[model samples]
Target chain A: MKDNVKLMKGNEAIAMAAIRYGCDGYFGYPITPQSEVLETLEAQMPWETTGMVVLQAESEVASINMVYGGAATGKAVMTSSSSPGVSLMQEGISYLAASELPALIVNVMRGGPGLGTIHPSQSDYFQATKGGGHGDYHLIVLAPSTVQEMADFVSLGFDLAFKYRTPSMILADGVVGQMMEKVVLPEQRPRRTEEEIRRQCPWAVTGKDHGRTKRNIVTSLELDSAVMEKNNERFQRTYREIEKNEVRYEARYTEDADYLVVAFGSIARICMKAIEDARKEGVKVGLIRPITLWPFPYDAIREAAKNVKGILCVEINAGQMIEDVRLAVSDSVPVRHFGRMGGIVPNPNEILDALRRDFIDKPANAKED
Target chain B: MTREEIIRPENKVYSRPRLIDDNYMHYCPGCSHGVVHKLVAEVIEEMGLEEKAIGIAPVGCSVFAYNYIDCDWIEAAHGRAPALATAASRLNPDKVVFTYQGDGDLAAIGSAETIHACTRGENIVIIMINNGIYGMTGGQMSPCTILGAKTATSPYGRRSDLNGFPLKVSNVVALLDGTCYVTRQAVHTVQAVRKAKNALKKAFKNAIEKKGTSFVEVVGTCSSGWKLTPEKSNKWMEENMFVNYPLGDIKDTAAGLEEKTVEVKKS
Candidate 1:
């Protein structure tokens, strides 16, 4: 990836990485912030050179279903959409989850209770980590803060998706999606052959042949309650395994910090700036950036809490992830939330101010003493 | 004559296609799904695409079409089969892909997918079973439900003002230039069954040949759903179904077979 360094928007990086990762199909409907992802793919014309199939679908529903079709054939397929579009794709996403097919989805989030704004906001953290669709299911959620991460996480997301046979999403926000930054784009990997696909994904609907008596049938509808319950249990076990194994996070200035800040996606980048600023002032404030939002780096945070006075959960929303942060710390240390909702990504100075007020300047309680 | 001589291999005219699995269809005894499934199997077996054919089954009466057809099957969510089939056909250009859907699956919730895939000229076959009612959900009215037709949802005989007019999806899609072939046939009668099978064959052949969308709407009878006997339903189809949905080739404008513009001289 370091060989071909290029400055591109986060959306463009995702598109380039998808092609470089040997994605066989890209299906998407244009929406703001992430529309550039589709535009860049079309402009690059991967179909002419790499034979990757790209289609501008009718709607997000159709787009996700298109992803289903490609994924069913054991191909590397993906789709990118913003908030409203991602909402429409929930049904298909749940189906893909139920079928246990590997596919990549990128949600460059915009503000929304309902079409709230086009500006960056991390309001969809809960939706992405917890099942975004009906039924008991979960997607492997990767939150990328930087444009470089946007590019790298594409491959990482796909790898995890295929490894677990579950859908994976890169949950960035409008800021990371719109901003331009240097990224080392990966070299183009060729799409897999039919033989390779069958070998890689034996459960795929890859048409029966080579003395394979059982034709693959992909469906989620099991009428029997007991069977469906067992399927749910299997998914729960997989989630537990993922939690135990795939927890990823990055800690900064936490070696001798008094208070810790928790954030992810674009807000994590902002929190990093605040951590740096507070460190310059001799304020013992650190940051924990959860790369994988679902398996919420709980053990790492618990370890961080062993020294910190408390934790401050920072976000661009009305504190959705604070609950998870509290769960991580087990309420032993004081936990508080600071956020600015409705497209307002608070400044790093404001986060430092909250850190100063919430933990730095707070009087020692009798219980703590 | 001995049993072997009486029923020679040459004299054996009827047999199940190899692709039709031993699992019997869950359709009603008199339902036309069994016949259509056989035709699809016959086409795939005849074309020798058993190794490459992928069928996307819809979410209606024929949702379990995968059980009967021994091919790679994708049970699509509701009416989203067209979108899925489009991706399948486009991504794996060498593979033959098709969608088997019912009237509700094609004309109602998934109308957008069906129309868009057609307009995009996706190289896929859409096998539509328009039985005029939702048989899977216990005979509710579908988008293709006829006027004055009494269904579970429309128990008082559907009125145009109360319920919308029936959707003639094949006829509407035929208007799209993207479609290479569009036909409406029935399977109630022997001759009609043969015609329907021919239509399916052409549709599958179009996908194999990389032609654009091929849509085949087979006006079928749902005797259990229609609250009639199998014979009565077939008879009713002849008298009423054909009146609105005439069984014939609505459009046949594939590129290479366009009326033989270069006439051959009779030598």
Candidate 2:
């Protein structure tokens, strides 16, 4: 583990993890902050050394489609972009989700109503956690606060995607994408054999075999409402099963802490720092970092409610993940939100102040568990 | 029990290929889609790519092209076949991939995808049929329609000032460095049909060989859109449309190879 440790940015860590984990192709367009991802891979992809293919596409739309195409061949392929670019890819993403193609998509979100700014923002929480595209489907949205989690989550994302035959996303913000941190890489796993992939994704378009008894077709179009309803039900059932098997969360100091901070992605990183600061001042504050935003750590929050008096939901957006936090806590305890929108990242000092003002100062309002 | 005595069904003699199903086409009488379909099927058969090929069918007149083409077909959003084809080809590089598009589908709304696919040199074939009118939408003015050619939108002949000049898709695609073979052919007569077939075969071959992007624009006739009888529409194409949209190879890699070698030598 020590040997695998290195200082790397979030973007580089993602690219390296994808390559080491046998991701055979990457298709992407150049976007700020995330452009380093393409640049790093472009410089290193000496076709001889790595048998993978890297293509700089003309646009985000084309890039995502390319990933769609490569994934159809039962190969692990991925693409990355910022918020506006990710919006362009929604059409393809919806198609991928509908077709049940296993692929990875990373969105280093910046502020956006339409290209609002280039800085960090968690405004895309609604888009990522709920369905971004126009369809009745969901992407397994993973949010990583640390560079190490960014790398580790990608490998896990690919695993879950292939396991369920669905598209998965690593929903990070610009701050997490651009910030540099120390990380310990994991041992490279053996590439899944083609037979294994074929066995898993039996519906993949590997060309027709004359000897096969029946042809396999992959499509999202179901003209019959009843049939489409049944398909949606099946998808929902799978999502429920995923919710059961894949909810991940981390709690720090929640055992005795009076206030709990509910956060994710880059904002969660800042909350950890705030938690540390508040603890030094004798303010009993803890942090709850959500790793999987879709299969949200509801149960974890419910359990924390047993001891924690109040929860402060912090995010880069004005309020998106706060809604989820509120839903999870469900009036069992007082829940408050602190956030900054339009690319403004909340400062650690500001969060510490919010903790002092809302929970520490107002001890009477802090409900006892 | 002799082998010679064993009898096989006569229906198996000329059995339909895997990609082509037994279904009647929805195209109008004397429309060039039948010829185009046969040419594509013939090429697919020749290259033995039927089992591996994936075809993206565009909206407009060719929306139901998937019904006739036997391969795995994906129906794309309006004018988005190129993007869909790009994904399909990139995903299945070993598989033969192509998009069957019409004038409106390729030249108008999908222009961005069409140009980008060629510019990126995506290893795919684009079969664009330019019939100078939108058949599915009841004779709307298409991007490939000639000057002074009146349709439902341009009832008093197309005005260059009011409406833009007709788009030359083959010429535009030829300008892209990624396109290895770009040609414009007509399917008016038997001789022209043979030439168009040859061009189609070359384009598919180029894609199969992984040479680069290949585009073959076929000038077809739409009698229903033209409001002319099938016989008269053939004459109209020969007399009017052919002169404006001439049939010839806009960019031929085989011919350019000599010039490229010379340039390389100089460099």
Candidate 3:
């Protein structure tokens, strides 16, 4: 068997992985649950001795715009905050997307309608997957369940962001952000050469040099309606391609199962444990965990629908993911939802009981296999 | 004509353009922005910091100052030049970074950013032009406008009961410990222009030495707002404005012990 990794908190793993991965800048304002990230960077940055810029801005707006400036220079920059801070950053995030700048933002969600308590909650699922800012754009949202995944996703998120020339987000709740678990970091890589960055992002603000072209203008102001429409259409094409190419999901024991569980992030972790317990009790249950929440794992959900008798959507929010599950399963299978709200995390045993009562205890009314 | 009576070649030596080019400036005629830009460019060249210096331009009239100055320039959003300059200086500590901002952009919209950046003691320079009115917006009253000065918004003259008094930005910024240099100067005559240029150069040099944030506010003339010729506007600034906003160093580390008493309180 493979050896388990050393234990670390999710936020600590993110900060370490970001440092090791050659991130040049970390700009953020402190908010609950995500403060560990800045604290860790502050302690570790002096020792690294690299050209790392870590600044605690006055507000979330300033932090995000700082990331904007760093990203405009083709640097690997990131920021993290809770819900209210993230809300303040919507304008800058929209501008970054419009400029097609590569950046990373981590959202450690808390309960909220306005100035909500700083506790673990998945209420931001819709805000993350949907376009959080004005205009037609999307951020590649990665939902991580484990501390190991948290570390791995930081590097992966940067890679995807640079590849797509779009911002990427690691959407995690307070539990995933604060929980401790074993994580193994990836090997470090050299910084990208100036020539390579120029080739990759020719529009970066590198200043005008001799014999070079005039400085490029990075703005989202297109006064002409036709030109604006064309830009929007171009973004749509890119989004469609991303949907086809980057959809990631995991399926466990879906073959000839009577019930399938659909979930993501921390809620998915609990659902997995519930599936294992139900299996021990001879309940034919499986799991479908979506890794990419934006280009959601719709294809996997559709494929699992062929054999499972029913689908149970589990989440920390009330009936949020259920809509997506229904969209994938259509009317072919019966889909039920079990969730908790306002920083309350659903227990694995409770999920297992919901699965048994919904699938194993009920007689087949609309079975597929 | 005799050789002495003819215009000698040596007379053209000092008359040659120090900074401003022969091209027609895009600014409205009599705009003090042209004079201020020339002073900054001359200072940069005099200090031999052209190659290693980066300037940030604000969204007001000075947004296009980069076109006139031959150096690395980054155009920032409205009132965000200071924040941009802060990040740029942090990223390249060895390079000299400065921002050119107007009264509306600096004192009105970006007051928070300006205050925070100064408080952080960022190793950068901020050159603010206080013209008492928004020159770019066709003469709207600004935060630095004099009390009872009439403008587009304050058609009945600014009142103490309604619009409050003029804000002294240099005095406000001088209260931050992070700032190593703070001065309020005016450019109403040739001599005042030279003095203002020297003050700006000193601020830039201080920032380059990694001393701390250095700020210089130049009390400029808005001929268009005052409905006067450029020469008359300069006289108006010298006769009226300089009294309300004096031309001198408000805070500087090298000045003396008395000046250091006004050092900004560190958070």
Candidate 4:
């Protein structure tokens, strides 16, 4: 381990990162396997050091509104929860989107349909990438696969959130949330002063300066249909700008591969191992891991699909991200899904077997074409 | 007297609060929301907090309160104003933060948010306007709808078994250790309006001093909702609503009253 390196859970990294990044406040409710996030913040006492407020709210619903209030003041505020809790926060999340506020939401996802388990699952991929809440809105979703990423994405998420004045989410699964790994903690940045906040966030509701400035109102409600439609158009424009500029992904060994593995979060790590084993067996395989799930790496996947004969979407859920992969390649290459449902984490060997069975051995895709 | 002389500053006995915007209000005639809004605006102006005041408008007739009050405002989701106010006040301890809520928003859908915010002792002011009926949604039965009162939803007149008793949310919060001040007031008469304004001023001062949650409930009239004229609605509220939801201070730790009886549990 290096000077900056420390072994910690992904959940712990998120708390540590938030403090170092000078987050103004964190309001959350405890839910496993992400309860460690709140516990770590409470133990660290960021309030005494960086003056970051940490509060255990009565419920996820309350915590999200707290974030909304803090965000309206142009403060860096956030909340973390698991599936059921995040589900309870949908209305607030939609309001955040409609208000065009900047905030962070971390979802250490667990098995669900309804409290399926406290174990790892990527079933929330559709919920995160598509709109989890009501209204035509999108969250800047960052999927972290490692403890290092868990620490890094906090500042990055805040940066993008403030840049666009929109909500950002770190969509990590239970595996990444619970597993321990080495992380290089970022340097501490001081929290912004009141004057700095007022200047940086002129649109924020930091109160009118005794008529020196115009009153700022933070709200999502617009009763006029014509005006609301214009607001929706503006949101759509912001989304288009994000999609064009923020698409992010990491591609490995796709240059000579006959098949590609598309995945994200913890499952991407599993897919990478499967690809390594497949390459050793003389069956060329590669991996494409999307870092930003909302502004998904459609172009990168399409570029990689040019060389690959078929693509396999490996997830912890049945087949959520496969639809996106299909939409990216658009029948130019055959795309299939391989996954384990209900909190089960598939081994590398199982993934390789599926890859071989579906692509190499049968080549069922080629015959169908 | 000449028109110019009558309009002189010395001749002026009353003036509207500078914080109140010139836009027309959307409230029904004789609705207490307008009077309450004016009182809030006046209090913020009188306290010299017109610039550093943040108001949380709940989902009800007062949802457009932000338009009338010239200050930084956050229009919160229905009944979630207290939760929003909690963070705003905590983050900006030096600034004034308050929530404007109605009966249905405060006592029904937002009951958990309201109760918990008080229990947490958040340094915020909560202004609850209890009209005994849902004014915005075509006069539906609200949690504060009195026993035997008639509403659209309770057309048969609220029976004890069929409909629950009216919720005295102010009394409920006054019992909580987090509250520094809790009072119920109204604005039906000129004298009543003066008293209600004083209550709001005290509440805002408590919020500025960071003395935990200060709750002020205004038992007011809803003319259209009650299917009565504005003047009759005020009389009805005074006769019926006042008996159940009585006025006067339920708790006032800020005035050193009941300091020994109230055990404060820090949040």
Candidate 5:
């Protein structure tokens, strides 16, 4: 393996990849499952090498506001936290979206309505895909199923974030965050020069251009109701553009299957194994793993619904993403949800059993012989 | 001298700061925000930081401060201006960063952000307008509202049982090791305005020198909120607000010009 390749946990890969991606600054607070993201950056001392500013903020609220401030200067900045901490950052996220600032936020999911278990759970699917904060806005949410994708999505998320001038999130669960796997890290990309930043983000508040340019004011406060409505219209237009262009998903064995499984993140990795086991038993189950959870593969799921008899949406949460699945499939195919909650990661055997019980054995779901 | 000669350039003694925009200010006729805004513009212009200045505007009556001050400005969520200023200054070391906030913003909602930023010794200037009440919310009680002062929330006189004393935020921050300059000044008189402008100029100089956190609390008045005329508002502040928030410097350690940087250990 090359020097860029190493065996590391997904959280470590996120830190390493951020430095390689030439991130200008990282402001975050410590949280369970994702604390290693900060620990790894501290260990690497990226400031000595790449001049990446890494500071342990006082709280998630302060960290997200720091991100808002840093993003206004047109530099690549980000923050990472677990479910509960992410909840504290919703107001800043809404401001980031409303001001059209480009920044990255990583949510390593854990079970929760309130200080739930630190173990892996996909319960934040609704929060990430739907508007997690107030107002009509969307974050470009990318779900990574493997440690390699964890490293890869740092740059990809930044690209999409800057392209749309909006916030982007890497929605990984605790399993992918803590699990160690071999990964190839990207080569170093130099941070953009101040002049380059000025050219790229002309609307950025990079100080006044003396009198040569109009002073840029970064704010979300519009007292004029009509002007605020126009701002909302512009945001809705950008979201429609994203939905039209950026839907991504991976499908397997759907060409000759009677049952489909909808899943994402690490849960999709588990369902891949379940599909293989169900196929051996002649159940013929396929998998559709959504990579981009926001521009959710609704079209792909709808296409697969035509070939399948019934769909089982397997996740670590209790019936959150299944709503999107049902919305896509509509009445054409019967859709159902099967999962465990409170941090218990369902195994392949249990998922296979769910497939048998929910589709293969259930008379209403089973196709005619 | 003739009237025309008296107004000539050679006879002129004062002019508006060129950095201030031409838009009509939204501040009430007797509000201190307009005067302080002018002083800020003057300081930034005199220091030649207009091009390299980034201002964080807070959510209060001065939330539209960006409209009056012609510089790159970012409007932060209520009380989060210090956290925002920290990142803005750290990422762009050459840029001059400052935050303008009111009592409710600085002492109430953003107290943690203010204390932590000063504790971390972030190199930014924080200009606090301690007006004693929540003027933007129509004279509601604020953390800095004095005892026995009546506000919309405190319809009856504020009692020690129901409300606490005014927060001497500048005095609190002056004791922090991270802060190099902390002062409380007012803008109600000609002498006071000059002293306040001097305090701001020193704070801005400290910020540019990377001395540490520089806090300047201006004891201001809200004529409308206080239900007093502009002249009566100034007199009321002197007799009532001055007893709680006295004018003059509380701490000035910029003479040391010490620069503290925490070194991260490399594994």
Candidate 6:
């Protein structure tokens, strides 16, 4: 109660935080698991108080396009969806990326590969990090594990989005979305002033009209291969800058642990509990929870890997983030993947058992030896 | 400033709009895009909307339309211009927002977006360039491609059973209660160009007045896509396209053409 703290679901926190952080507009469609986001926003009716416009768009395609439109005007706009709905929004996401517009997209992930289940799953980890649509583009991805982070990351994502003039995605799974916890929502931030927007986002098409300044044309269409290549190169440089400056993660017990566990999102929270459980059994286990999936905290993982015997990559999907961990460790230490696929969330005991099997059962070659 | 002193026989009958950029258009000679661009620029310039007009360019042949229209422009993905225009207009109520799209972009791939934008009564102008076939994609059969029309994809000609009926999207949009005006026009002749410009002017004005969605379908000619000369293409459109999509205003809520006022119900 110190800072407007209240019990809330992660999804509801996202909705509340979006409104509190001066989000100009929200466009979304109803989908399993994540439907509470739309419902909460509608129930709150922030338009009456904050002048924040919310529209339940006809489809995911329309909703994301609306974000693309609103972003073109330098407005803090966003859309939320689950796995299948996120799939529908890929084209608009690609367009937003190409146009170099800033937007916040929340994917409260559900089981995938074709509406597999209504329960939580991390199946979209690959789709979110890789270029989901047809283009050479990437979204600034944030993985929020707790209801508090769900509330906190909205502003962080928007700031990073506007900073790079790129779309940002808050990738939270179904468990994180549906689970309730105490969250102290951020203080209300006023919407950007017109003068602030004009100064901050010169490329935004505010219709300051003709001859006022150089016309702002927001488009990714470059017919000339040479020009397109230059644009792509510029984006790559920005990504490299983000990698250098914005790789975020939380490392625990990594200094003295013999085995490191790399995980993200809700699974990371589970892994932290598993690390504690392993510690009770006299197992020196540590966790490297990556908060930013894209521009992933590879350096941190590599740093942690240096002290551990081997790394176990834990996930809710069949080894999606493991690939990134492998790239980070680079065969210097053995990185094994353990995951539960298709909506079944593995418990902390199961994760500790996995560590027991990988380390205790086999006194195998510790990479250091 | 007497007429006798100011008026001279050598005075130009027409001058290019200031908004029309100096860069050459990539469209084929005699393409309807050139005239359409001229008219749009003129409307924005004449109304002094030069400072307040925002345009959306849909993916297709006119994807580069922003290059010619010197204003704040947004290039949307294929078939998503209406959605983009809706956001732009909704957020900037005082600004004139419009989308320039082709038959394939609006009636084919973007039909849902186009229909929904109109149904929501989004205050935006939609200038649809309908040449019946997909022009930029090497003349593929579009949703509005005429029955028995020959295209690259329809070598033997478009069969009714195979391709289905041609869509009159403007007519369908006119039926929506949210739409303020729906008109079909052409620009092959001098008089036709004048009428087409008039239709565009009205559409842009409707957006500024928040009179709901205004759609103007330009019955255009794709000379290269139709495999005909510039003159023959216009003739073909006159004989074929005009019959399916007739010219003139089909609905005009702004002018009180209908007895029913604003029907708030969305389709």
Candidate of highest lDDT = 5
Query: CA shift at B209, candidate 2, in angstroms?
Result: 2.6
Chain A superposition TM-score per model:
0.97, 0.94, 0.94, 0.98, 0.97, 0.97
* Residue B222, candidate 5: C-alpha displacement in angstroms: 0.8
Tens-place lDDT per residue, model 3, B68-121, is 776667666677777777776776666788889999999988888899999898
User: How many clashes would you count in candidate 6?
Assistant: 3
In model 5, pairs of residues that clash are none
> Higher-lDDT candidate among 5 and 6?
5
Question: Candidate 2, residues A77-196: lDDT per residue as tens digits?
Answer: 899999999999898899888878889999998987887999988888999889999988888999988899889988899999988888999999898899999988877655555567
Ranking by TM-score: 4, 5, 1, 6, 2, 3
Reference interface contacts recovered per candidate: 0.85, 0.30, 0.15, 0.80, 0.85, 0.75
Pairs that collide in candidate 4 are: none
Using DockQ, give the best candidate's number.
Answer: 5
Per-residue lDDT over A151-183 for candidate 5, one digit per residue giving the tens place of the 0 to 100 score:
999999999999999999999999999999999
**Candidate 6: residue B7 Cα off by (Å):** 12
How do the residues A293-315 of candidate 3 rate in per-residue lDDT, one tens digit apiece? 98898889989888888899988
- Order of all candidates by DockQ, from best down to worst? 5, 4, 1, 6, 2, 3
Candidates ranked, most accurate by lDDT first: 5, 4, 1, 6, 2, 3
What DockQ results for candidate 1?
0.74
**For candidate 1, lDDT tens digit of each residue in A37-93?**
999999999999889999999999999999998898899999999999999999999
Runs in model 2 with CA error above 4 Å? A1-3, A189-196, A213-216, A363-369, B1-18, B28-30, B74-80, B83-93, B133-141, B147-158, B221-240, B256-267
lDDT of 5 at B132: 90
4 or 6, greater by lDDT: 4
Which prediction has more favorable TM-score, 2 or 4?
4
lDDT of 1 at A146: 89
Categorize the docking of model 3: acceptable
Q: What is candidate 1's lDDT per residue for B1-267, written digit by digit as tens?
A: 889897888998889899898995688877999999999999999989888899999998888899899999999999999999998888888888999999999999999999999988888999999999999899999999889999999999888999989999998998886788999999988899999999999998888887789999999999999999999999988888889898898888853434222567899
- Off-target runs (Cα >4 Å) in candidate 4 are A1-3, A363-369, B255-267
TM-score of each model, in listed order: 0.96, 0.89, 0.85, 0.97, 0.97, 0.95
Which DockQ values do the candidates obtain, in the order shown?
0.74, 0.38, 0.27, 0.77, 0.81, 0.67
